[model samples]
Target: MAEVIKSLNLLESLKESIEKNNISDIKDAVEDMLISRINIALVGERGGEKAAFINSLRGLGVGNEGAALCPSSAAPDELAVFPNPKHPDFRLWDLPAIPSNTPFDPENYLERYKIIRYNSIIMTFTQNSSSNMVAVWREARSLQKDVYFALLASDKDTEKTLEAKKKASLEVLKAEGVSQPKVLLVCPTALEKLEFLMLLEVMLGDLPEIRAHALLLALPTFSSTLVAKKKEAFKALGWAAASLSAGVSAIPVPLVASMVDASIAVRILTKAQISLCLDDESVERLARQRGMDPTKLKGLRTCLLSVEISKSEVKRRLSVAEKDTSTATTKLVELAMPRHARSVSRSFTVMLQAINSAIDDMSADADKIIAVATGVSQ
Candidate 1:
């Protein structure tokens, strides 16, 4: 497809810029991949369920840093924003709940919360508030905003009760003039379930391709399936990191290229490790939330970078790469060549190998952690 070619060309252009040692262009390209803004509004009641859902989506716990503040009761006039701890560019806005007893004003709701700026508006409805939610949905629809409905289900909810709740929501929407209604039933306490994945798939389908990719990378690894998907997305990032590494290590000073390669690998792999939730913070939080000992859970991580991502460790990996003379040159090395041709070529190849191996190991560790957290067999 032409679009695919354009995408590939854009990456090639970035590689060219990096090869030219354009530091500003390299930073901008890397920033575009890591810090693209994505705003999603969760229009729902101020309660534990919504808070937990927000935290789960952002891959945080109720009390963790950057987690959504869980309110004790519902407030229909408050707006709280929570940034993803790992990816601050992706924000979750908790908008005011729809009033069940009063006449709801869609215009004021839309303007007061600045709903127009949101990439997507998710109206989370309880059993009794679908009517007001439908009112807001109609307005959001008119503005051509991506909108969705969700109903929180608890562990106590039986199949029949959940179906009844979903049916009741659809009936309310139908009465309010919506031709067809779909309410996603999500368990806020457990986001790795089938329903939540379905909801995520629908949302991703509607998002622009680039934004969808950003969202996919920003989201926490909730399941093995998600880990696998993230692994594929991170491959492109791996190449980008390698190009940047090669650009920075173009210096001709003896041993400078090797040292610079190790440093760049550490920086890139550290970010990758954190994004995969292989960091000590995420592991400890998971252990605390699941009532397990943190040390034991940390012991389960298999990736070298997962254990530690430092210059010394990365240098060791680079040494291993150098010793393994049979390393295959990747497209990244071919596409991006620096000033010191020979030194940069070898350094880039070693960095690429280390980065590729690190990404694979981190992804596997992420999947293992998710399996343990969800009690699912890998």
Candidate 2:
């Protein structure tokens, strides 16, 4: 049987870190969780639809501002980087295409591309997988990297041809000593369909635990699975912030804790709004991409935090949150930190309650917006 791993209790660690008044560690933790670098490398031939795949993953259209330049050509020694407009820290890199005639050195290629820095690598192909790329894939596996094979299909491909391509790719990988290889057949223009979400889920499973939450929040698509994962991620974020606030205000002064919690609430809610694409800019961007009126998209918002998230607004909400000692919030606090359930202040519980409620509302707004954009009933 596999050994069970014990998860780290971050709240406990934060409490200890705060006992020494060492807010730096918890502060750094929060910042890292909020804006960590997540780099993905895409290795494909020029005009192999790498740019389209990257743009789709980043939720950008070809003509949109900050969209990746399609049909990319790059020098053999360098990697071309494309940053997500909403989250600059997340990037997609287009690695230079392998030379067909040259004797490829997988080790040298991996080193030249600086593959170690990337969180994941995706090898995309329109045709069969190149022996050279497969060699690099093998080398990447030896280094314990999360590498995937993706077959880029287009609107022209029929079901039979798509399955044929996937089978051919798998055969190539298996022949090259890959056991039970899984190939993702992806249509770049239609990421909401087919194996794209499956690919995302697989990658999430393979990624480091710390990165799973970030990846979930960073994804631009609005699906039921993603919505659920995003809610859990935001809940964890809220818990972290609440725990940190309680630590900072160790004396448990309701006024001081309330102020700290309010500030943290603003940060969390603002991030939630953008992550769910409910912010004005994101909504307008989504509308423009769909060739719809921005006002129509904006009108669907029913959440308080869906609009602009201001400090004054957040404070007002917290004032109201502090008034009602909701049983749901109390139970959540108890479940989150059982040992300190009795001692955790009212302000901390209230902050969690308010943050949780706001996230749910924003999630609902996101669902409504997606339904309207896709002309599907929610």
Tens digit of lDDT per residue, candidate 1, span 177-269? 888777888888678763878888888889875677678878877788888766766666656565666666665567766665666567677
Residue-level lDDT tens digits of model 2 in 129-178: 86777899889988999999888887678889989988888888888888
Q: Determine the C-alpha RMSD for candidate 1 after optimal superposition of all C-alphas.
A: 4.0
Candidate 2's error at 68, in angstroms? 1.7
lDDT of 2 at 94: 87
lDDT of 1 at 358: 73
Clash list (residue pairs), candidate 2: none
lDDT of 1 at 16: 67
Judging by TM-score against the true structure, name the best candidate: 2
Per-candidate Cα lDDT values, in order, are 0.74, 0.75
